[model samples]
Target chain A: MDDSQLKRRFAEWEQEYSKRPARACETLSGVSLKPVYTPLDLPDADYLRDLGLPGQYPFTRGIHPDMYRGRLWTMRQFAGFGSARDTNARYKFLLGHGETGLSVAFDFPTLYGRDSDDARARGEVGKCGVAISSLDDMATLFEGIPLDKVSTSMTINGPAAVIWAFYIAAAELQGVKPEVLRGTIQNDILKEYIAQKSWLFPPEPSMRVITDIMRFASEQVPRWNTISISGYHIREAGSTAAQELAFTLKDGLTYVEAGIAAGLDVDGFAPRLSYFFNSHLDFFEEVAKFRAARRIWAREMRETFKAKDPRSWLLRFHTQTAGCSLTAQQPENNIARTGFQALAAVLGGTQSLHTNSMDETWALPTEKAVLIALRTQQLIAEETGAASVADPLGGSWYVEALTDELERQAREYFRKIDALGGMVRAIEHGFPQREIADASYRHQRAVEEGRRTVVGVNRYQLEGEKLEIPLLRIDPEVEKSQCERLSELRRRRDGARVEQVLTDLREACAGTDNVMPLVLDAARARATLGEICQAMKDVFGEYVEPPMF
Target chain B: MAKRLRILVAKPGLDGHDRGAKIVARGLRDAGFEVIYTGLHQTPEMIAEAALQEDVDAVGLSILSGAHMTLFPDVVRLLGEKGAGDILVFGGGIIPDEDKQTLEGLGVGRLFGPGTEIREIVEYLRDRFSDRVAEETGD
Candidate 1:
């Protein structure tokens, strides 16, 4: 471990590898990976000072002392698509398959707060995920599933409040008290404008709505994660590994500032705040990214925000296998890719994980496909024994080096964003957009030029490969079924109550009052998603992007 | 003049994932074609109207949800009813191969899936447009 011996070993390994030649030495984020590392590299590194034991300051190893030993990570298989009944069945199936938690993926119409029968929602009902237009649909979606037992994470952004209102109402109908209802609402609309492009209101108003939910949830749903600041979609949108880490942290910081500005203590709501990360193909990079993310968030939380509570400093996250990486060509190969990605998630110390199905590239995952995906995680947990050890790669020289490098690169991005006046300002200036576009372009060029091999894509030219895997096909009647349901709900609901709730929602939008309570009231009254959003639109107005270079 | 090979890049539904659409739009533009990107959440009527107003040579509808069967044919039928039948209507998404064939038979030109290169869409559009032009000129 001495400096001289470390140098000798590094040189010796360099000589040995020089003869063999490296397959690759570059991180996915383009950081150059040195062949070896030793004590010399960490001369200034204080192991006790830098990486204290888990659950301590600068908690790089993990948030908890005994991570998986205390309790295994939540296996939340993301489901929803088709009629509420169909999606409900899928949820039950996943739960039966040993899934510990539920992550609901809403269809496009529901995501945008549209009813299935809306002109804009024509062919989209139950397409990508379930169509929950009202509390009726939400109730149907969670029909038999006990609300208090299983935690749900709804992947909704623009209309997060409205959709969450429906969820709260549905839970209330099930006799689950607001305090007992556990789940997360991906109410991070800032990221929607930044990457996902799913914004209903402009950023300023959107932030206000999000802050209100944070304010409310801190008191009501104490166990619920108010906003899961997601880097998964950012990574899926073609960001580099470093970009994902940096942008995600930057976003997390923005939310903290927003919460503070909203007259809430930093530690009050910060403990419940969570993150969602993407587990991409590069195994080491993903692990390093996760480690660096924890280190940066913990340090910033304590030093910058002065968060007193240890729980406030912890960066708990949910990890999903990279969907963009799944290829329709050689569909079965996605299984291996998903397995490795899931393994990276486990090694990275994700609090929860969702492994993407092989046929996800074509449509919503078939049951068989989803079973394989879930089994991928089960195998990693039981057979691989990866869960037995906490941060198994923590002491490895290469992993530590990569982690340090990732932190440095991400800090650089953070500094750049800070210079540009934080995340919102940077988004306004289109800095993140341009960076991702350039990164996406570079990655595509690399694939085309054969610098990076995507198996069946850039390499392994399988001519006329017949896809053997069975792809999930949504019953075309699902759309009709959804439309019929929407039609019936409209006819059955009391027209007078719907109008009254819509008026109240519009009035709240026009005033400084918290609209989420009004949203919940509307959901309880069976006001559809489209109606509630339309009420808000009458006051807040719609979004139109300005053309720029 | 052979009419500037106009194409409409329309996001037909609520799926806001537009990276692929934007990339394809930029690709078509770079390939010497005029692409009218109708941003996000356009109804079938709006799409048909935009195509007619832009006088596009083709309409490229992008829908990621499994709603192409209902949405795609709606646009196709609306285009026909609106007297915009000559325009080639093509699209892409997470569509099953069987549905792709079905949509193509209903006058959709081509269905592009994930990993479908923009270069391929560009080449096909060019060849098909040129052939149409040639047939019109009796060449």
Candidate 2:
């Protein structure tokens, strides 16, 4: 029989059988779910084109032919907090425990381009992530970790170019050349305006800095993934999966356009560009979202931008299990949540992964909780048979259908974004931010109305929940000591040289020149992150996000 | 008629995690409370000043950068100095129990953590301002 007969039969079966428990048949992204999917559901299911071989063009199944069978996903836990010395020790600890790569989490001050001594850095010196204020601190941050041996990913934006310069200088101190260094910088600034909101300069100047990095990285740090076009923050900030996929890819496309506008070849820089996504709670939806992400990217790069290189069509992403999905109630339950999410990520063919610690909702995770998180990934990679095959769930009718639907939705968003004159213009008018706020409010309302079930939150009620887990406490003395070190560096460094390099940086920011070399000079001259940023800020001015949800 | 229940929902410190604050602000708004949102990267001084100027019934400060100890108490003290000490102070974020207790000791009202129902915060505010709400709604 055909689709009509199958639909009739499905309706008859539905009429005869009452749905048990009476749950809403829908994904977390609010896509209405059908009871069951048949082959008829995929009307245009062209297997060769839509669901191609694992490593072929339109790589919907997987980016690599033998994804995990050849090599396991890099288990890079994002580790940082306190002073550079403190975070450096943690890196050694993680490496000793079998972690394959390094991911740095910079503190609030450093992320915002401030030294610990800046007035704005008060009470926040080493609170969120590791503090790296100068080349000295960067050197200390990776004192023993050989930059050439391990691939590192830094979560920095706004001032990503300067921080990257500091990293290169730090590596050079260890006798590592720039060409041999392998790492990624989270330099996607479009999302900062749209979701994360940790911006420094206005969009035009920010884009200028980014394009400079793209050109510089292709020549100098060829192995480095210039910008990890991110959806992690967008998802964490409460967007549905469709928005995250659309906005992130749109941001990536925007960067490609920016690169081309700056007179760079598409194939030149596109190969090194990577992606970052969130492995959220809805397992199948997330898997489909990832598959759809790769396919959409491959198609768009091949068709839209006329990218000739097949490497430009690939969408290699690093996945971090959803931090928002973990509940504070029954904190231990987060381990299981993270485990499932991590598995979904691997099944979706992630290139690398970060599993959030159970106690992250309360504070920065303690040592034990961090270990449990790392072990969660190890279990999936080594013990569980999930990673043995590429795209194990690629043939599932439900996943395929969802993949089609998500791609359709993302394309619809791309049209809306294009009509609004691209993502930057959309962001200027707060379109994406408003969309995320509305969706987040809707999800909250669903939970409040008992339409959605959050395991420990709305259901399985735990009364007067006392989170007894060991919490990592940032030492208050961290701020005090960090300030002392900053003052010491300032007093000892060549003040005239610092001022001269900063002046040169301001000129580079104002004129049509790549600011990377000057930024490296400033980093080498012992100019602080704050001072270097201040020099550019004097020319570009700081960004002030209009009041938005 | 009595004035509407006015509350200030603000993000303090450098961290840009504003999802919880914005949700709570809208939740309180939907619950018939007037919420003044301070957007992102708000200083404690700015928050206290805004609370005083707006004459909000309470100031709800959110911080997840692990600087709650420094930011929260500073906001409360500034409020007291500005002579708006009666404005209820409360918020949500990634605060430990011990820090919560100390903040409570410093006259900050009940704090909520992640996964808190928006209804719970709504009810907390409703209970705190029961007199005004009853007078306004004429219940």
Candidate 3:
């Protein structure tokens, strides 16, 4: 049919549909969703310019031509709790159960650069994630797991470099060369300042440390991804989808600028820089956000930064299903939510994905719940056939329009951030924090006022719901044993050598020398995580955020 | 008239998850209470010291690192050592149901979990403070 006939048909359908009006709906980002979409919605879309062929420039379709046909996205589950030995068993269990890679989740103490026995650690030893204090704990955490055979992604930020030094030292003990090490350190501290709030040093020194890692990794650990610029934590901290994309990509750009300013070539380090995103409940909107992220990153790297290599232009990212979207009311329903969200990530061509377990809303997930979450990914990959093609929804008019709209919104944010000097300056001024707080408040108000329907929360309430699923309870004994082990380690290690290394580290932090080598030496000399962090803290001091309302 | 019911919002231990604590602080502030928020990574001793220095009537400790079993009792003990035992000590985080009773038994006033309404916390504080005032005044 031609334009006039299509318009007439739409008018007739609208008249009939209006008689039985459906409830209005909006996406998680507050974008209104239309009932029906057609060619008329995408007026400015150019087929070649906007949605290029897969593996080509402006890769809205995907970064690779064959996509999953070439190789399936890595099924990496984020798992860690208790001592290093305990987490190692879980790692072996996951790898035995068909997980493709490992993602380590450190506890609060480790994330804050505190040893298991520190006074501040108290009852937090291995509560949220595994506790890796010294190189010994790192060695135990990966006792039999071959470093060359599998890639690892560690989710620690403030003390990322120190923990990474422990991992490298552990690998060295296993006779693994730095060149063969494949993994990612979430050394993205800007996001820490913005959302996560796990920062150790202030922004300038933190950026210096991140640049040091990038330079060292690019030269020595060529296979390592230096930083996984994260939007996952930002979204989990209650930012909207557009805000997540914009703030994250801007953070990525800030890192790029930092690397360049530090005298590193863009292509040399940019290819290894990756991203982590959150796939929320809105299927179409999440897919569009992912697509727009790629397009925007590619344009900024190639056009703005004048990057020459295509590898530098690629926007490789890992995605995790949103944990904040899970409900404590009907915990079982979380499986279905995770399934749909994982499918969205897969369809959006994520390089890796971690699906949240059903019991996470209450405590750490049980082994049974983790298996279900893993099986959800397997079913998506093997049974659902969603992985059979690249960008299955690429040509849909609604998706394209949404993708364009998201790109437009992100560019607006970029302009605003640029006007505020940059992301660091914007964060220092509490721009992103205020934006997220406002959005969070607005969403909570919507839920409270019944304007939004959260299943099992406001509507379809179940009376006197009892949580029947088994919750994973970390034994308080774990903390006691970990503290004992740390004391034993301190007693065994060479105190004079540790002191010498720490003094050297403190000097390096005070000077302009790259501190990664000193950190590596300290790790090898049996310097505890807290000891190394304390040395730097003595030099760089700690970061205290301004009051953000 | 009772000095606006001063409260110290402290995040004890190493947990960096402070969204709930910040929200509650804001809630108390909007409810006309004087709120002093101690940022992340406060030890039990530091928290007690802050309570003494700020002269807060109550101390609200927010911990999500599953360290409530150790941190809560330590805070109470420290406050007692510092001669501030009469100050109200409340808590919140992802504490399980069974642990809630244990924490309360350890002298914690109340423990709020996720999805708790902000007004519920405000009301609980109001009622507790008013009761303490009545007892002191022999009403």
For candidate 1, lDDT tens digit of each residue in A85-166? 9889989998998999999988888888778888777777777888888899899999999999989999999899999888
| Model 1 error, position B101 (Å) | 0.7
Interface RMSD of 3: 1.7
Candidate 1: regions farther than 4 A off: A8-24, A546-549, B1-5, B131-139
Ranking by lDDT: 2, 3, 1
Give the least accurate 10-residue stretch of model 1 chain A, judged by summed lDDT.
Answer: A540-549
lDDT of 1 at B92: 89
* Model 2 alpha-carbon drift over 4 Å, by segment: A1-23, B131-139
Distance (Å) between predicted and true CA of A162, model 3? 1.5
CAPRI band for model 3? medium
- Model 3, position A398, has a per-residue lDDT of 88
Q: Tens-digit lDDT track for model 2 on A1-549?
A: 578888888788777666555655889998999777878778878999998999998999999998888899999999999999999999999999999999999999888988898888899989999998999999999888888899999999988998999999999999999999988999999999988877899999999999999999998899999999999999999999999999999999999999999999999999999999999999999999999999999999999999999999999999999999998889999999999999999999999999999999888888889999999999998899998888999889999999999999999999999999999999998999999999999999999898888988899978886767888999999989988998999999999999999999999998999999999999999999999999999999999987755
By TM-score, the best candidate is 2
Give the per-residue lDDT digits (tens) of candidate 3, residues A220-298. 9999999999999889878899999999999999999999999999999999999999999999999999999999999
Evaluating just chain A, the predictions reach TM-scores of 0.97, 0.98, 0.98
lDDT of 2 by residue, B1-139 (tens): 6578899999988889999999998988988888899988889899998998898999998888899999989998898998888899999999998999999998889999887888899889888988876887785
Model 3: how far residue A412 lies from native, Å:
1.1
